[model samples]
Target: MRFSKSLIILALGVSLAACSDSDNNDVEVKPPVVVTPTSYEFTVTITNLTAAQPFSPVALIAHTEGMLWQIGNSASEALERMAEGGDNSQLLTVDFATHAQSAESPLPPGEQLTLTLTTEQLESLKISLATMLVNTNDAFTGLNAIDVSSLAVNESLSRHSHAYDAGTETNSEAHGTIPGPADSGEGFNESRDDINSVAMHPGVVSQDDGLRSSVLTSQHKFDNPVAQIIITRTQ
Candidate 1:
């Protein structure tokens, strides 16, 4: 009887040890987790300060390098398209721009428009915007690649922008060349008929002033600081 009991006890001990070994072998080893970088964002607000001139839908770009237009330099074909005709499709798709956006409609006098853009990083970040003054011939207002890398989230700054002539088209202010409602004429002519370098705009000479053939009147005239731009970092 004693011998039979010893055999039973030894068998039970072996079974328990085998179950313990199996439990140890089945322990789980999880793989490491992966993480992604957060996005940085900015918001831009543009207000037309002109009394009569309306601004075309703005082209807004967030880029690491490159500019929309540079003073004394020849205007790019994309810029000429916007300045001459208020078309911004090409400017938004430039190679150096990482993110771009456009306003939905023309910003009328005294009105404002806001837009937002986002990216993964902020090193060497710049903001550039361009919009045509619909009442003028190839005149535009915007920032040329303003460096905003030092701008902190929730911070803001304002710039009172002056007008610039694309110099691709003459400021003829003729009956059929003005694109605004004053003339409702042609826009974006491909010919580089004027001095082919960008420069500060000379105020428009309307028919009321001296240009007899001018389709524009004194009401369409504007001076420096045609637009007020405010930039804010949101995230």
Candidate 2:
């Protein structure tokens, strides 16, 4: 999440280069050196939108193409680790990633965290982000393979993301199965004991929602659009 001042200035130069105007009277003008940044500075702002579910530190990556998690596909081990526990180390180190960044701490309910990522060129311009809903079992939010090429300098794009189930683990909601501050239990078991495909997370059914043995309560329940993510071309 650190960028040098020189890199920041160079990014600003690229933005300025993108805005040149040519007059009709000009006989011939050379195109600006499209300093297609071998690297670019991207700013990501994540806001936890849940009322009570705090989010784990966000993981952001830039890749060529391909989603981090596909709806009908099984969750990757890296994703499973993050969804199950709050650890983003494996996800940040996924092989296909061209560049990556991670937040230093969790984003509490209604809190926000901003991070900067730099990647070389549009070849790695696809953006992916993920973070766990700390109150649930294997639930996470954010987008995958979002095209950022068209984003103009200083412009931004924002989205509200829903929770997704890694499906590698069951939604038992038992006393010690759930991770996060609510349970402080174990994370990332090697078992594929649940429905092994990614899907929109069915909101947790806490003790208040009829799951008697559940350690969670009504305060931990959540619905769609759990987090707000904003990306700016802040070279």
TM-score of each: 0.85, 0.83
In model 1, the number of clashes is 0
Residues 1-235, candidate 2, lDDT per residue (tens digit)? Answer: 3568889998988876665433445555777888654657889999888988988888999888768899999999899999998789998999988888999988999889899988767543789999998788899998988899878779999998989999988899988887888898877788988999999999999999899999999999888889988999876
Across 1-235, the per-residue lDDT of candidate 1 in tens digits comes to: 9999999999999998888778887775647676668788888999999988999999999998888988889999999999999999999999899899999999999999899988787889999999999988899999989888899999998999999999999999999898989899999999999999999999899999999999999988998899889999999
Candidate that scores best on lDDT? 1
Which candidate's TM-score is highest? 1
lDDT of each: 0.92, 0.87
Off by over 4 Å in 1: 1-34
Q: After superposition, how far is residue 37 of candidate 1 from its true place, in Å?
A: 2.5
- RMSD in order of candidates: 14.6, 10.9
Which portions of model 2 show Cα errors greater than 4 Å? 1-38
**Per the 3 Å backbone cut-off, how many clashing residue pairs does candidate 2 have?**
1
